[model samples]
Target: MSPVFAHGQLRLYLLSLLNEGPRHGYEIMRDLEQRFNGLYTPSAGTVYPRLAKLEEEGLVSRGDDGRKVTYTITDAGRAEVARRQADLGDLEDDLDRSASQLADEVRSRVKGEAADLRAELKAAAQEARRVAQPATGEPMSGRARGEFEQAINELRQSARSILRSRKTAESVRAEALRIVHEAKRQLDQLK
Candidate 1:
């Protein structure tokens, strides 16, 4: 299945995470972090709401043993988890063939790519922090702050493309790639 990374997706993740056994929210996050190799350790805000949603859907039932709210997958949730597991297997096999090797090939590719991404994000955050300093640019006044918020909103909108289905994701990826290419061209022009 196309694993959604949104807050709503936490239902699927929580169900899937608890397929082996019951777990609380933090336990679910820890399991996901382990499974995803620390690429995503979902925050409480993302996890809890999704768990609540799952409960409402009857996919995840909560049992307060004593302290923490323990969640176990229902029969419907188990079937959903089974379907998703098969989907995940298909996705994995496709990824394996796409890279023309085992999953390790992709993992090997990530080392450099992740490092570069970390550095770039770090630089961007540093730049943003520097630019947002109270001493500079009048602290982003009314219209400017609105514009910044608008930009952020658009980014979140685009990021939501990942939540789309496989067919839709293909189209979204094309658009995203086009945008990335344009950004690269602009950066080259700046250089």
Candidate 2:
């Protein structure tokens, strides 16, 4: 949860969003996630209750359209939005700040995780090379070393590409961790 949506601000913001157009609950949740850059995704539990509350307060009205219920801002909702124009502006500013901060935090965490993964991979490669050495204590053959290095480089590049892709940071992080873990597992098998 974000402080931007604290203290009944989410209700007001939801009203602001409905002011733009009518939407179902899922669309409202998706819109909020997009607006926050995927940093905050409100579950149905969080959103539906607030919507129900707003409906109870006569700030919004819902129309059943078969399987979906579309919510629209009532005249009272528009009035509330009009009355709290300044607060809405402040909330927007807070949202921008919070999104930026969350993005930075996610980047920092991913960077740290990537660094740790690199260190572990490097150590595992060195250990594998050591363990696979001949009785003469000779290093791995040049061809074998080249192939190993290339594989490691490719893995690193794949992780970097995932991080830089258009996917959300959370998804990127998960994919990167998956790659790292799989690589580690494969490396451990060589032991």
lDDT of each: 0.59, 0.79
Candidate 1 accuracy as TM-score: 0.43
Q: Write the per-residue lDDT of candidate 2 for residues 1-191, one digit (tens) a residue.
A: 23546587788889999999999999999999999877778899999999999999999999998999999999999999999999999988878888888787777766776676566556555645554546676778887777667756766776677676664366456756775776677666765
lDDT of 1 by residue, 1-191 (tens): 22335333445557767777899888987876665554445689878888888889888789997889998888988988888876656554553343344234445544444344334434433443433426443566776566546544554454354335342324344555454454445434432
Q: Residue 94 CA error for candidate 2 (Å)?
A: 0.8
Best by lDDT: 2
Model 1 lDDT, full chain set: 0.59
**lDDT of model 2, residue 26:** 98
Error of 1 at 90 (Å): 4.4
Error of 2 at 98 (Å): 0.9
Off by over 4 Å in 1: 1-10, 90-191
TM-score of each: 0.43, 0.71
On TM-score, the leading prediction is: 2
